[model samples]
Target: MRTAFFVDGYNLFYGLLAGTDYKWLDLPGLLAHVAHVQDPASHLVSVDYFTSGVKPELATRGIQSKEAQDTYVRALKAKGVQVHYGRHQLDPAKAPRFIDKQTRPSRQDKVDIWKLEEKETDVHIAVSMYRLAARQASLAEDGRIDQIVLVSADTDMTPALRAIREDFPAMQVGVILPHRAGIERPPPGSLKDYSHWMRRFITEDELLAHQFPARVPTRKKPAIKPEYW
Candidate 1:
C-alpha cells in the first residue's frame, strides 16, 4: 500500500510529546515504522506536518522556545517532510472561571483572559487530505495513494475522514491517536467510525527509538537539539 501521513503537530505535541525528552523526533522514520508495524506492505510516500509558528511572547522559554521550534522544523524539512505553517491568534476573551472539581462553571462568573488559538490548521489538514485523495483518484493504480493515515486525536478531523470514506470509498483511511501508552485516553469513536483502522496509543520505546541526532546538518546552519529539551 502506498500510504501518506498527515500529522497535526499541535495535537501530537500536547497529546504525546509535552514535557518529554523526545521532542527532537524523526517524524518520517516514526511514521514509517508505525505503518510497517500495522502492515508490512505499507509504503510511506509522503508526510505532511501541519503546525503554527510559536509565539515568542507567550512561550515558556520566550525566544528560545521559538528558536527551538524553528530548528526542529528545519530538521523535519531536511528529512523531506512537507511542513505547512498556520498562525497563532492571541485575543482578549472571557470564559467561565474554574473554581473546583465539585463546582460547576457558571457563565455569570467569568474571567477575562488571553485566548491563544492556532488558526487554519484543522481546515488545512482537512482540505489537504481531501485534495490528495481526489487527485489520487485520477492517477494510475500504481501512482495512487492506497491509504491516508491521520496522526491526530482531535475529533475535529472526524468530518474529513467521514467525507473521504463517502467520496473515495477505495481510499483507505487510518487514524493514529497521539496518546502515549502509559496515558489512559479513550479513542474518539467518531474518528474510528470513519477510519478503516485506528491505532490508539504510541509506546514510549517507539518515540525513544525514532529521535533525531543532536545535530542535523541543513543547507546553511546545523539544526541543533535544544539544551533544555
Candidate 2:
C-alpha cells in the first residue's frame, strides 16, 4: 500500500497555540511520526504541508519565529513534504475593539491584515490527491493514493473526501486529529466504510517530544512613537 499525507499548517499551528504548552513543533518531524504508523506493506510517496507565509507584524508578536518558520518550510521540502503556499484571507473584525470617549465609547472592527496570507489548502489537496493517483497510473490508478490521510478537523475537505471514493473507487480516506492528543472523532462524511477510514492517534506526549524549542528570548525595545504626537 502507498499513502500520501496532507496537512493544513495554519489550522494545525493555531491548534497547538491555543491548547498546547509547546509553542512550535518540528513540522516534518511530526509527519515522520505518521509514517512510522505504517508497516512494510505501505510506502510514503508524498507529504504535503499546505500553509501561508507569516506576515511581518505578527511575526514580532511571538506567535512563532518567522526565520524558523521559513526553515521549517524548507526542511519539509528537504524531507520530501511538498510545500504549498497561499495568502491568508483576513476578515474585518476578527473580534472586537473599543474606544474611550467623554460620554460614550466608540467601537470599531477592522480586518486583521497583519496575519493575512495565502489560503489555498483545499485546492492544493485536490490537485495533489489527483496528481498522486495520476503518477505511475498503472501502479494503482484510482485517481488517488492508496491511502489519503489528512490531519485536520475541517468539514471543508468533505468534497475531496466524497469525490475520491465515488469517482476513483479504490482510494481510501483517513482523518487524524492532530489536537486533543488522540481522543476526538472525525467529522461525519459520505465516504464509504471500507474506502474511507478515520482515526485519532496523535497524543500530547508525542506532540511534546516533536515540538520545537522556545525561540531565542529577546527584550522589548523602547518605543519611538510619541504619545499623542
Candidate 3:
C-alpha cells in the first residue's frame, strides 16, 4: 500500500510532546515508526506537516523559541518532510472567556487577556489532503495512493475525512490521535465513525526510538536542539 501522512504540528506538540523530552523529534523517523506499527507493508510516499510559525513576543522564551522553531522547521524540510505553514495571530484587545462544559452559562465571564491563535492550519490540512487524493485518483495503479494517514485528533477534520471516503471509496483514510506517553487518549467516536480506522500516536517507546540526534548536520546550516526544550 502506498501511503501519505498529514501531520497537525501543534496538535502533536501540545498533546504528546509538551513538557516532555520529545520536542526535538525526527519527523521521518516518527512516520516510519507509525508505518511499522500500524501498517507495516505500506510504502510511505510523502509527509505533509502543517503548523504555524511562533511569535517572538507571545512566546515565553521570547525570540529563542522562534529561532528554535525555525531551525526545527528547516531540519524537517531537509529531512524530506513537506512543511506547510499557517500563521500566528495576536489579539491583545480580545477578552478571555471561560466556559464550564457541564453547566452551560448564559453568558460566560470575560477578562482582558492577550490571545495568540494559530490560524489556517485546519483549512490547509483539509485542502492539501483533498488535493493529494484528487491528484492520485487519476494516476496509474502503482502511482496512486492506497491510504492516507492523518496524525491528528482534532474533530474539525471529520468533514474532510468523510468527504474523502465518500469521494473515493477505494482509498483508505485513518486517524492517529495525539496522545501522552502511557496515557489513553483515544480519538473521538465521531471521528472514528467516519474513518476507516483509528489509532493512538506512539508516545513512549516510539518517541524515544525515533528521537533526532543532538545535532543535525545540514548543508546550508547545522541545526542544534535547543537546550531548554
Q: How accurate is candidate 3 locally (lDDT)?
A: 0.84
Off by over 4 Å in 2: 17-24, 35-40, 60-64, 90-118, 134-144, 182-195, 211-229
Q: What are the per-residue Cα lDDT tens digits for candidate 2 across 152-192?
A: 66666667766666666666666665555544555445332
Best by TM-score: 1
| Residue pairs of candidate 3 with colliding backbone atoms | none
Per-model RMSD to reference = 0.9, 9.2, 2.5
Worst 10 residues of 2 by lDDT: 220-229
Q: Estimate the overall C-alpha local distance difference test score of candidate 2.
A: 0.59
**Model 1, span 10-68: residue lDDT tens:** 99999999989999999999999999999999999999999999999999999999999
lDDT value, residue 204 of candidate 1: 93
Cα lDDT tens digits, model 3, 1-229, are 8889999999988888888888898978877667767777878888999999888887889999899899898788878899998998878764536566675544355667777788999999998888888888578898888989898889889889989988978888888887865776555877798888777656587778877888888877678899897
Clash counts for the predictions, in order: 0, 8, 0
Give the alpha-carbon lDDT of every model.
0.95, 0.59, 0.84
Question: Could you give the candidate ranking by lDDT, starting with the highest?
Answer: 1, 3, 2
Candidate maximizing lDDT = 1
Q: Give the TM-score of candidate 1.
A: 0.98
Model 1 ranges with Cα > 4 A deviation: none
- Report lDDT (Cα) of residue 219, candidate 3: 79
